[model samples]
Target: MASSINHHVMERAEFDRPVKILIVTSPYYKDIADEQVVGAKAEIEAAGGTWDVAEVPGALEIPTAIGIAERMSNFDGYVALGCVIRGETTHYDTVCNDSSRAITLLGLQGLCIGNGILTVENYEQARVRAEVAEQNKGGGAAAAALHLVALARKWGGPRKGVGFKPASDEIQIAGAAKGPNLA
Candidate 1:
């Protein structure tokens, strides 16, 4: 089975500066969410990083909170933690797909985010994944975010002006005296 294969777990990433990460979680499943937060916090602390926690109403709100924080706060990265167990209704599929998609879209937008939200068939599965002694998906997610932050630091900064460029005439230079004759 996939679980039987020996996998390399990277050592905690080191940061030259104090890396601050924001963790957004849904306490809908309190036990699962708490476990995830515990694991995430442990990983971040081990990596020489600091973190803040925020609680959202549900999984769907996790990304939204991150988005708001990305715009209004200065966190270096984000960790999303939640658990969505399958239900008898179609709501399960919608929650699972939409939440995952939102997290992916945010990552593609250049936000360093670790998605630890669990979409499982039952509480048992979530228990196994969320347990720090078992899979520890929470720690995995925090590690993922740290790795992305390290990569970003290695690259220095993001590319500037990727999509659009102004023409020569459209570029305005500062400190140059404007000619009075030019209308």
Candidate 2:
């Protein structure tokens, strides 16, 4: 039944300026991570955008890395790539939920983000989703970020500090004479 489902992929985003995306990946499964990275890179390149890759120890760290990058770097968007294979322990749920929650929080703060971390029950599921020739969830994630970037560009105008006046405008007191100083 899942195979019968139809997915309608959106058209790739267009950009007037160069788009740079930072990919934060957890290489807990090195092979799977690599495949996902390849797919992400291909998608970004196809959209006339560039990307950089960052590695974290596990899925739990991916969002933290992206948050750091969002603050210290000038990337236009971010792609989160990782795999969480369900295990006997509840640690799996914590990593999956907490990482996803962190990423969502970052997005809410106006950062363009794509969440591609796969939470799968088994290695085969991760493989099918991560493989370039298969589901290519990495590419899907990149596409999601790109779409957000496009929307931000469309709806977001010049950046302004919250509750701050524009730098070009000056406030002057009425009936106050301009004088050089009496501190």
Candidate 3:
């Protein structure tokens, strides 16, 4: 089983500047969500980073919340936390796939987001994963975001500003010949 297999965990990311991460969680399963936040917060603090929390109704809303925060807030990264335990109907699949997809799309758009939402077969599975002493998937997610932030910092050198460029001191017509200065 996955619980029995050993995995390589990356060391906490190093940052020269303060890292501020926004953690968006869905507390549909309050117990699980709370545990996840604990793990995520611990991981962030361990990396010398600070965090703020935002709650959503469910997994599907977590990504939207992150998107909103990305536009309105100054957080360097985001950690998405939630739990979707399988149900008797297809709602489970919809929640799991859609939420995961949205989070991926946001990441592709250059948003630093770590998806920690658990799509588990049962509460027991979610429990083990959410528990800080167990799988600690929340911490794993935070770690992922931190690494991404570190990479962004490393390669994100001076960026060009947006909007129209300023006019040059001397403006020449498009069809003007450069043979002589007609001033």
- The superposed Cα distance between candidate 1 and the true structure at residue 117, in angstroms, equals 0.4
For model 2, the stretches where C-alpha displacement exceeds 4 angstroms are: 1-3, 158-174, 177-183
- Candidate 2 per-residue C-alpha lDDT over 16-118 given as tens digits, one digit per residue, 9 for 90 to 100: 9989999999999999999999999999999999999999999989888998998898999999999999999999999999999999999999999999999
lDDT of 1 by residue, 75-146 (tens): 999999999999999999999999999999999999999999999999998999899998899999999999
Better of 2 and 3 by lDDT: 3
Q: What overall lDDT goes with each candidate model?
A: 0.93, 0.92, 0.93
TM-score of every candidate relative to the true structure: 0.86, 0.88, 0.88
- Report lDDT (Cα) of residue 151, candidate 2: 99
Model 2 / residue 81 / CA error / Å: 0.3
Q: What TM value does model 3 have? A: 0.88
The residue pairs that clash in candidate 1, if any, are: none
Which candidate number has the best lDDT? 3
Q: What lDDT does model 3 reach?
A: 0.93
Candidates by lDDT, descending order: 3, 1, 2
Candidate 3: C-alpha RMSD after superposition: 4.2
Better of 1 and 2 by TM-score: 2
Encode model 3's per-residue lDDT on 1-183: one tens digit a residue: 579999999888999889999999999999999999999999999999999999999999999999999999899999999999998999999999999999999999998988899999999999999999999999999999999999989878865786678566465543255556667
Number of colliding residue pairs in model 1: 0
Per-residue error (Å), model 3, residue 84: 0.4
